[model samples]
Target: MAIDLRDPDESYVSFWRERHMCTLTTIRPDGTPHVVAVGVTFDPEGGPKGIARVITNKHSRKVANVLAAGPEGARVAVCQVDAGRWATLEGRAVIRTEPEAVADAVARYADRYGRTPTPNPDRVVIEITLTRAMGRA
Candidate 1:
């Protein structure tokens, strides 16, 4: 079910904090979805609204898909599940290649996943400024 983005439930918020693999769905140039498993992290300091982030290789197809769409960004959805509970965050995503942005995403990923990812010089961050959230948390 769709949930209010502003008045998010504490349980729902906690669910996102839980460690779980999420599937990021990015649109292909032909309008097909290209979904892949990824470790996602949420940042609550972005603005009035927090954003979800996924760090990946700069040359990854997902990053390519987002770039192929347009400068505004590509529509994307990230979903996670565990047994009977599941949740999804959907929004427009853009590729962030700045060193600071990539480093910040890597740091957040480490904090959430317990270990820093293998250092990759080609790292890039897909920043999703959340527009909607839904789940049965």
Candidate 2:
């Protein structure tokens, strides 16, 4: 069953606020999953109600995959595991290159990770509008 996280519970919110790593899965043009360890943040105030953002270089494969998926956005999934507790977020992701979007992503990242990431000319943010969330936690 899918959990709607637009109004997530305290436990769900807590899980995201705590420092934890997540694995992002994006689909390649050939229908394969390109999974990678990524630093992500849950922005309850950004994008739609339940948005998850990941920062990456414009040249990254995940960026390419999201862009290649076109205007409708790409199907993406992010999963985080901590011992017996785990959560998976399934959503539609879009690559945002606008300055404001990048700034917001960076700010959220800093808030979550406690450090500002070094600025890169090729930096971009992948904004995911979550549709389904599920897991033990």
Candidate 3:
């Protein structure tokens, strides 16, 4: 069963706040899954509201994949695991290239990871509006 993460429990929120690496999966044009390790942040108040954010280069494959999926956004999944504990987030992803969006993503990323990422002129933010969440947090 899918867990409602719109208002995740404190424990789950805490789990995400840790510096665990997450695997992001986006769909390739040929319908294959393109998975990559990414630094992500759980923003309960950002994006379209209650979305996970990933900041990456504009020319990256993941960003291209998301944009290729069209205006409604691409379907994506993000998962983090630590031994016996794991959590998965599945949602629709929208690529944001606007300055305000990028700034918000950068701030949230720094807040979670504790270091400001070096500014990239070609940076883009992938905003995932979760539809389902699962696993043992």
Which has the greatest lDDT?
1
- Give the alpha carbon lDDT tens digit for every residue of 39-134 in model 2: 889865555568999999999999999999999999999989999888888899999999999998999999988889998989999999988888
In order of listing, the candidates' clash counts read: 0, 0, 0
| Better candidate number, 1 or 3, judged by lDDT | 1
Q: Candidate 3's residue-wise lDDT over 1-137, tens digit each?
A: 35666667777778889989899999999999999999888866554437899999989999989999999999999999999888888899999889999999999888888999998999999999987788777
Which lDDT values do the candidates have, in the order given?
0.90, 0.88, 0.88
**TM-score of every prediction relative to native:** 0.95, 0.94, 0.93
For model 1, state the Cα shift of residue 54 in Å: 0.1
Cα miss at 22, model 2 (Å)? 0.7
Count backbone clashes in candidate 1.
0
What residue runs in model 1 are displaced by over 4 Å at the alpha carbon? Answer: none
- Alpha-carbon lDDT of model 3: 0.88
Can you give the lDDT of residue 52 in candidate 3? 92
Off by over 4 Å in 3: 46-49
* Local error of candidate 2 at residue 78 (angstroms): 0.7
Steric clash count of candidate 2? 0
In the predicted model 1, the residue pairs found to clash are: none
- Top candidate on TM-score is 1
